[model samples]
Target: MQQDTIEQRPDAAADWPDQIYDLLKLHNIRQVALVPDAGHSRLIKRCIADNTMKVVTLTTEEEGVAMMAGAWLGGDRSVLLMQSSGVGNCINMLTLSSIHRTPMPMIVTMRGDFGEFNPAQIAMGNATQAVLEAMGTLVKRADTPEDVAPTVDATLRMAFNTFRPTATLLGQRLLGAKTFGKD
Candidate 1:
């Protein structure tokens, strides 16, 4: 049944971002910190529109990581959204999560992999997962739209329940890889 929904139809993927937003609500995520990216526009907008959610637009990805630490300390559940290239910026702040065994749920929109077009995205995008894992973050990916909700749900549970940092990578398949002169 789960396989049928996840693997059978790409057409059903249209609402995956909404599904992720619903999961955030379900998880009682009260704070959202993000460095905006095109791939995350939908989710970011959803959170921003919600009055119950405290949404912070960050100057850098690392600030979001540190902010989550403060949020968790204050008994508020928080999530960070960033592009894969921003992952490098968060490495040091992730130590706060690691050292304190605090939950920091982050959603990353990937670049520089699969069908990536930008030359600069290649390096950090390729290294994102490795960097997160090195910081002891439980890393996972949602390669297709259908995978988004489930992947994010699991990461949220893993982070909140286990008190560990977790990241969900939204892959190019879902966001549509950026390419030259292609709409």
Candidate 2:
């Protein structure tokens, strides 16, 4: 497996997801568990393309929590990719990682903020960060394209290197606010 280093360039910020993929490769994160999400489409596609990573599609978000825990016990690094709405599903399962001191890193693409069109996405999305923090997971916010790479890098370090459960919330503003309808 080839490890790619993220270059510090002005245009690098535009490709934050790619930078994150590179960091994951650089750190040898071999397991990826996720609930399919449009917010994470690009990163998910990248993970699918990489032959070195084990990508698992989950039925529910909590399953990802359990998957990461198992992967860690097997001596492999793993990350969960989900949307903010999915956070509610993992609240109880999060205790497994927290109490057991398993390092689980989650990348959550936020909704119900900024230009969100669906009123249904509001409640859970607004509570995502608070819920994760309450469950003993360190939460980091990346509201800008420029902040994405650095926040992901730091979260990965804190989660894997320090054995801390961490969550990186990717704001909707950075992901281009979703529109209501299309012609």
Candidate 3:
């Protein structure tokens, strides 16, 4: 696919989560585990609503990781969707990612940056990138809606090809405050 072939303004097509679905479809990712966030609620809902993709809602981020790992071992491509704060919660399970050599891609919606007014999200938001990096993730930050599809596509391709985990930081700058928009 051409790198510049993406819509700039938000539409049904510019919906970040839908872009996720398109990328997964392109990658043949038949199953996925999701730890829903307001940031990803629409996308997760879309995944669950769509019959083409198998969606597993997880209680915690670690559960998502474990489930995706199992799917990968069974010869299916999978993705984990979660907010940045969940990264702190899933540290232990993250070790399994490296130990098993699971090359799944994680799409993380960053909080506590840019327009963030939440004091609670500060720790995880600040530490989010560092934590994932420490855990050996090849990270990329998408600062615009148009950037999301290609970044995710590239990250998934890189992770699968290298057999290493990859993370795409869905930065606050790109998404702004609200999760859903019709722009």
lDDT of each: 0.83, 0.82, 0.77
Give me the runs in candidate 3 sitting further than 4 Å from their true place. 1-14, 177-183
Residues 1-183, candidate 3: write the lDDT tens digits.
211211112234447778877788888887878776656766776677778788887788888778878988898888888888888887778787799888868998887655566678778889988888898888898989889898999889988999877889888776544313443
In model 1, where do residues sit more than 4 Å from their true spots?
A: 1-13, 177-183
- 1-183, model 2: which lDDT tens digit per residue? 001111111122257788889989987999999997766776888999999999999999999999999999999999999989899999999888877889999999887766566678889988999989999898999988889889998899999877868989988777753222210
User: Candidate 1: lDDT over CA atoms?
Assistant: 0.83
Quote each prediction's TM-score: 0.89, 0.88, 0.86
lDDT of 1 by residue, 1-183 (tens): 221121111232367767888999999999999998867776787898999999999999999999999998999999999888899999999999879999999998887766555677789989999999999999999987668888999999999999989999988666653333222
TM value for model 3: 0.86
For model 3, how many clashes? 1
Best by lDDT: 1
